[model samples]
Target: MGSSHQTVIVTFNQPGASFGQDAVAALEDRLVGAIEAAQAGEFDGNLIDCGEVRLFAFGPDASDLFAAMEPHLRAFPARPAHATLRIGNTEQRVEL
Candidate 1:
């Protein structure tokens, strides 16, 4: 079987029914520093319009990617947030 790449996906639920594109764009910009600081992952953009925003990041190490993005995800003014950390063939869900 092919090996799975390590990945971290942080999701923030919108307080309202949906999110504004401008806000999502701004949020993406806000995480640039964190991603760069990790020095191990790349922000693979986000998926929106589902009453939540999910940030996609992939790296050689899932832990490094999660560590870098955790704080930013926590500081965001959104409730019911969580992250899906995929390590190889396994996946773990972490509440932010």
Candidate 2:
């Protein structure tokens, strides 16, 4: 038996100009934890790496990946101007 891997990329839009540095940092930290927490249960996957603007993870498929990410997306303090979820070559813009 073999396992299939798909890349999941989460790109967050820039914060509003009024957001303070401290606030941005705090939000980033929370977002990191939320993103990491998404890897649980049957959807468990590897969080390969991340940056200030994006997160990269590998999972079995887009459906599981998105399902795991739903909560965090809903909890975001401010709706991003735009967000995107990319699984391999397929891309979907996430609206909150």
Candidate 3:
């Protein structure tokens, strides 16, 4: 992990009939793929879905993880909502 931790916060809109299970699974795949593709450092992170928002962290830090998550940034707003990834202490408003 890097000196500064990175965190990806996935804010989900109203979940579909699947009850977010599908979304969660897909997110996992996306995170793995992005990490491999980007060659990001190893870290510990998980998927956190808060009804209105779903957060995905790559590990204990957010730098490498943030770099790894670019591939999966487009998988959102199937209907109309928002998803954000906060790498550092400051919250950056990423376009969905």
Candidate 4:
């Protein structure tokens, strides 16, 4: 099979809100767990790589799949307002 690249952009509801040092640390831990889970196929989809602000996964199902992972994220100011997904050459924006 050919390679497929997927990117998920998560934006917070309150854009300027700060997460604080404690919250940021906690969030980092949770994100690491999420990435590990994705690599282990624990999520509905697979996550191949990730960064501080972006998640790189396989397939075009990022919006639906990542939405499910939202509740598990603890450091957001309110929920994520939206998610932007790029699968291969196609880009899609989704509001949450």
Candidate 5:
């Protein structure tokens, strides 16, 4: 959290990932970039916390937040190139 914000949690929803060094690294990089971009200059003291990134494509994890966020996530500059992001009008299908 910074000046006006409270907290920032980074999430990389790997529906059912085949955990591996390369896979983890890719997710890490993508998540970190998303967090950085979300800052939007509003907060400089962003804190990292541990949590799970529920897959936002379908099923129970999806919500208003996911619905609204997919589009924005697609716009993120460092989005994982090996992930299938059904974000907004852009459908970026990447494989790891």
Candidate 6:
């Protein structure tokens, strides 16, 4: 079942800045709950920090998962962020 799950990667472009750990953790919790409530997907609990922050989630459908997380992503204090929704072999980038 997990092998067939699709993925959504949301990258927050913070450049030289990043959100506080507490803030990010809170957002992750809220987003995960929202996604589960919507039956969109399961968060992989992966947070990558490079120059930006990347959040990952996986499910049977990427579009559905993206839809579930879009609002929260938009509500994030970060100004510039984007999500890469991968369904099957195709990927679509959305600015949030």
Best by TM-score: 6
**Candidate 2 lDDT by residue in tens digits, 1-96:** 124666445544554444344554564565456555766223222222222344455566655665665666566554353345555567777665
Off by over 4 Å in 3: 1-3, 15-19, 41-50, 59-64, 76-83
Top candidate by lDDT: 6
Flag regions of model 6 displaced more than 4 Å.
1-3
Residue 38 lDDT (model 3):
68
lDDT (Cα) of model 5 = 0.34
Off by over 4 Å in 4: 1-3, 13-18, 40-68
Q: Candidate 5: where are CA atoms >4 Å away?
A: 1-17, 40-96
C-alpha lDDT (0 to 100) for residue 25 of candidate 5: 48
Candidate 5: lDDT of 58? 24
lDDT per residue (tens digit) for residues 1-96 in model 6: 466899999988776666777777888998899898999879887565765778999998898998888889999987588999988878999988
Tens-digit lDDT track of model 5 for 1-93: 123322222244333343344544454455445444543222122222232232322221222223333444555333232333333334444
lDDT of 1 at 22: 83
TM-score of each: 0.83, 0.49, 0.57, 0.51, 0.27, 0.89
The candidates, ranked best first by TM-score, are 6, 1, 3, 4, 2, 5
Give, for candidate 6, the lowest lDDT window spanning 10 residues: 44-53
Model 4 CA lDDT for position 36: 58
Minimum summed lDDT over a 10-residue window in model 2 is located at: 40-49
Which scores greater on lDDT, model 2 or model 3?
3
Local distance difference test, candidate 3: 0.56
Model 1 whole-model lDDT (C-alpha atoms): 0.79
What are the runs in model 2 whose C-alpha is more than 4 Å off?
Answer: 1-3, 16-52, 81-83
Model 1: per-residue lDDT, tens digit, 1-96? 125458888888866745577866777776777878768778888887568888898887888888887777777766688999998778999998
lDDT per residue for candidate 4 within 21-70, as digits (tens), equals 45544554665576556552222222222212333334335554465455
Order the candidates by lDDT, highest first — what do you get?
6, 1, 3, 2, 4, 5
